[model samples]
Target chain A: MSAAAAKAKRAVRRPVSIASFAQSENVRRDDQHNEVEMLMPVVAEVFANIGITKNDIDFICSGSSDYLIGGPFSFVTALDAVGVWPPMPESHTEMDGAWALYEAWVLLQEGEIDAALVYSFGRSSPGNLNEILALQLDPYYLAPLWPDPVSVAALQARALIDAGKGSEEDFAAIASRSRKDALSNPKAQVAHDIPVETLLRDEYVVSPLRRHTLPPITDGAAAMVLAAGDKAREWSDKPVWITGFDHRIETHSLGGRDLTSSPSTAKAADVAGVADGPIDVAELHAPFAHQEIILKEALGLDDGVTINPSGGALAANPIMSAGLIRIGEAAARIASGQAARAVAHATSGPCLQQNLVCVLEGE
Target chain B: MSGQTTAEDLGPVTTLATPIRLDFEFTPGVAQSRFLRGLEKGRFVGQRCPTCGKVYVPSRGSCPTDGVPTTEDVDLANVGTVTTYCVVNVPFAGQSIEIPYICAQVLLDGADISFMGLIQQIPTDEIRMGLRVEAVWVEPEELTPSLASVRYFRPSGEPDADYETYKDYL
Candidate 1:
């Protein structure tokens, strides 16, 4: 083992804060702009809102998948949108933007860099999103079958019903409420005030998974600035403090695991201290409506929690960026004083195989 | 034992070849659209960064160093200098150009960045840094919104540029 590995554990207590956040308007197809173009305005807005330049940032990390664009080295090309002239420390995650934020958070805990920029973008309109997502499955068994995300999610929904954990009505209700809440959010692509009955009447895209239950195919980008210690206070008067952050992943084998409950989410919640305080709001990255029920239960959130006030992923799911947007949305609420404490969740892999939970609070 | 195994001897095959092919409709975005349109008109257009005043050909909409958009459009001359080059002596699949062809980073005058262009009409050994060159465009009738509109670059016969002129670009 290296000398650094042999050292005593370093408890990172340096408070990190979500200083600023911004997101592009979600659309069905952003034909006018490429991923970099879609991301430029959002990155600019994120930094502009905080009255700082790229020079103020010490580290930059982003999350995106090349599969969406059917190209490689896209993240490297994406740096053009950020203007890495002097060349700064940068990193990327092929998972979700939330994971990028986790990386930046870990970097900050080391107490070296004062701030970091986290951004992500996805254009689901370019390719067959369903077919593209199936590539994420295990190559040996699950992937050869070519089960799309909707079909996989349907299996989870069916499992939920089989276990008596949730009903199809519960899925409709979540979809209805999420879209209704999205009506006020201009960034949401699918927003409406539809009743549960009306939503249920909609035809099922897959068994037990209606068109309303599945997240809208969206092209969008989001950015957030994280600052530590004095920089956080200097940047925002109402800095949203990230009290606890943790992520966990379950087994990749779909047949081997229980689909009804998200044990990974429950574990992440415990590690993130989700039950330590009352959650005034939550932004869960449940691409399918029924999965929201699983997440709410896993996080141990009751009826009092205002879920997905920004319409959640149901309104606009921009693949790689959707998960980070949850964290940003949750922080925005706390920063605005709309909520004192908030829980943000991001999920990846088929049927929530991986999960991340972040607890945000305001002073 | 035989060199090849039978199905019974092979047991369950552990490997699978599942070829996944996905098509995409690429959108080049606003800045590249401008550059492509410029090519359609037989002009080399670039965008200048507002902060640094460095012009980028085929700007992807932002100044990479400053993380800001290059908004100002500047029409550039067809003439430039070869900042760097390599001879493709080895043949490979999807190889369109002949072997020993010169592929070079052409730094257009008044532009801050260099873009790859095929350097031809000269011997491979003759290609060198700071070599002056000029774009040879496609026939006007065949012009389209593509880099192909500028077919290639050839020796401009102008005096070699000072090494300092394009060292930053290199």
Candidate 2:
């Protein structure tokens, strides 16, 4: 690569570290409270715990899909948290919270900003979530047919079954494991081990995918604080440094491409170098039970690696925020000396259509 | 998590009934407009990348890798093998098809990539992957000057393709 090309690439991939992180409890559906009110305590605690004020931040970015709120430009209403009176440089992507964090990391790498804030919110209880998610497909061909998320995932699950890689028993085990893990997480909405055998007895939502195979319709918000190398050291004694981050999107139509596996996520993981490095923990954003198995194979994680200490999305899953919180939770482990390195994965669209993978290390 | 307002404050539930007709007189932007205009006459089309010799179905406005336009007009074959598919059991608003229908990605002959369409003229349970399907054309009067002019795909009377051939696609 020429110096100019190398410089441009470096400009896009600077090592930013997580300085602070916080989140609200994921609920079945927060109908009583609005997004802003639900977010204030999370935002305030994250900043206050780090001993920083609004003035200390240089940039803010968010990830959200307007389709969640049944309205467009939903991020505009979130400006109240930043007190935009003294405005700020900000942008948003129609992705999950993890991608928003990626955008902030890119902006920080530009050398213009030392600190940034990333946040996301999603409320799925207001609508029929399974049906609402079908809109994520290609509007021209796939979306008009309205194949829900679970059915698409079931196709993948069936493929896994056909390929002899997984089965309904294995999927039930993942659900049982997640609910058991959620018992320790205060913010987890679905937190109980119902026993895999009992779960397997439940009726299918879309054949091969039982009701327990899906996460509840959750509404919640999450935020993470990022700072450049020097700023990171100043903010905390231990910082979780982002070493590699990459995201890739595939064609939106379901039938136009593969379904048994997630090539987009696998390619993204390869680009992000998740397979090359040593990972002690992984936080994968697999809302459906079966997706967790697919992402595990895509990222090439071993049995040695700890997965979803935050109980995974099957426990909480607040749509847009769930992905970003995965990054935040993974980074927190590294920052707190719980893990030396970790990989965080996020997915959007039907059956993991678009995916982002981020690698972080402790310094 | 910050600055996101509550449900009541989010605003009134204004259901937009806007008919989002994103009809573009797309000048192919870079590829062959001739192939696109052929849709007006209900023709399946593609364009070949001269340098790579790759025939892109719904021919690339630009090559996937080089980002260069494919200019030649290549009217495509109506029949192909299904690479993969999903039963769209759930229905959406403004949907033209019924539920429990099979939607498959058909790799039309001589094309580099597959295109999606409804698998018709067969039982839903019988819509297996790699099933040979021929394009069912719309009536001349119903031709819309778009991809939708092809009513759907039906069994092509060819042998069901062995799954191993398209396993990579799955």
**Best-fitting candidate, scored by DockQ:** 1
Candidate 1 C-alpha lDDT tens digits along A1-363: 453542222223678999999999988989999877889999999999989999899999999999999889899999888888688999999989999999999999989999999999988988998898998988888888889899999999999999998898999999999999999888899999999988889898989988999999999999999999899999989889998888999988999899989999998887777887899999999999999999999999999999999999999998899999999999989988999999999999999999999999999
**How much native contact recovery, as a fraction, does model 2 achieve?**
0.00
Name the runs in model 1 displaced over 4 angstroms. Answer: A1-12, B1-11
What are the chain B TM-scores of all models?
Answer: 0.91, 0.76
DockQ of each: 0.75, 0.01
At residue A268, candidate 1 shows an lDDT of: 86
Clashing pairs in 2: A34-B5, A34-B6, A34-B7, A35-B4, A35-B5, A35-B6, A36-B4, A36-B5
lDDT of 1 at B47: 97
| Clashing residue pair totals per candidate (backbone < 3 A) | 5, 8
lDDT of 2 at B19: 34
- Per-residue lDDT over A1-363 for candidate 2, one digit per residue giving the tens place of the 0 to 100 score: 675664344333567888899988888856644454456667777788789876788888987776666655658756545555456788988788888898888788788999998888877766667667776666656666667777788887887789888889989998998889889888898989699999999999888999998887788898888988678889988777887788888886666766667888888777676766689999999888888888888898988999898788998998888899888889878877889989999988777888999988886
TM-score, model 2 to reference: 0.66
